[model samples]
Target: MTGACRRARELVSDACARWHLPELVAPASVVLTELVGNVVRHAGTPMQVTLTLRRPYLQVAVTDGSRRDIRPVPAPDVRAEGGRGLLLVRELARRWGIAPLGDGKVVWALLPAA
Candidate 1:
């Protein structure tokens, strides 16, 4: 899982650099990690991560083989390591959402490119 997260971060960072949107690297990396990590830890199924340039936003999408709906919950315990991924996504992303995709779903975040 750690390796997958690291690779996702590197991919997002490299894409941001290539697109000349260096400012997006940090947020995009964070968002990707959180989204992908969620799939790894919870879904435990096949997943796909994608980064795309969409006008003024850089979009990150994680598609997983699960139909369960995901929602951001407030962490009841400050010391808990889990349950904070979506919260971080909400904070860092310009906007985020989950959409049903056949038998699974795609969780996505958009960060401002400008």
Candidate 2:
């Protein structure tokens, strides 16, 4: 994993720990992993992951160098083990979206801080 991604996980876990929210730490890690992995896979080098916390909510934003269109597509079959990262993100995250950056975009996911 990239340093930015590893730091994101640590920051999120630390934030949850500070808030006395141990329950959310693991899921946050997993979701962060998937999103960050996507960035690493699709966007090449020079990526960043930012983490924000707001009492009951936590937002993770991953910035990468792909101005090209990228959208999360579900697997064609339910039993398919691959191409399910975004689906897992959708299921576990409270809300998620992509936002335009300087020349790329930021894929963000929000989760309950608790």
Candidate 3:
């Protein structure tokens, strides 16, 4: 999981640099880490992370090995130190959702390219 997060950051950083869009790296990196970490924790397997460039958006997808219902844990007490990952993604991403895959699912997010 940690390695996945690290690799995700590396890939995002490379994309940002190659695209000459350095400003998008931080939030994208955090979201990627959270999404990939969820895959490792809940899906019980390493996941695949991919990034795609589009006219006005960047698409990030993380495919996990479980089709378990993955939903955001809403309204945790502020003092609690975890479970806010998906909530953060919901708030930060322009758009996001989960799609069923064979024996698994892929969670995806779209962020503004502008």
For every model shown, what is its TM-score relative to the native structure? 0.93, 0.82, 0.93
1 or 2, greater by TM-score:
1
Residue by residue across 4-79, what tens digits does model 1's lDDT show? 8999999998998899988888888889999989999889999899999998888899999999888655764788
Backbone clashes in candidate 1 total 0
lDDT for model 2, please: 0.80
Per-candidate total of colliding backbone pairs: 0, 0, 0
Q: What is the lDDT of residue 46 in candidate 2?
A: 78
Question: Candidate 3 deviates by what RMSD?
Answer: 1.2
Each model's C-alpha lDDT?
A: 0.89, 0.80, 0.86
Give Cα distance to truth, residue 14, candidate 2, Å: 2.4
RMSD of each: 1.2, 2.3, 1.2
Q: How does candidate 1 score on lDDT? A: 0.89
Q: State the lDDT of candidate 3 residue by residue for 18-57, as single tens digits.
A: 9887878998898888898888788887678899889598
Worst 10 residues of 3 by lDDT: 69-78
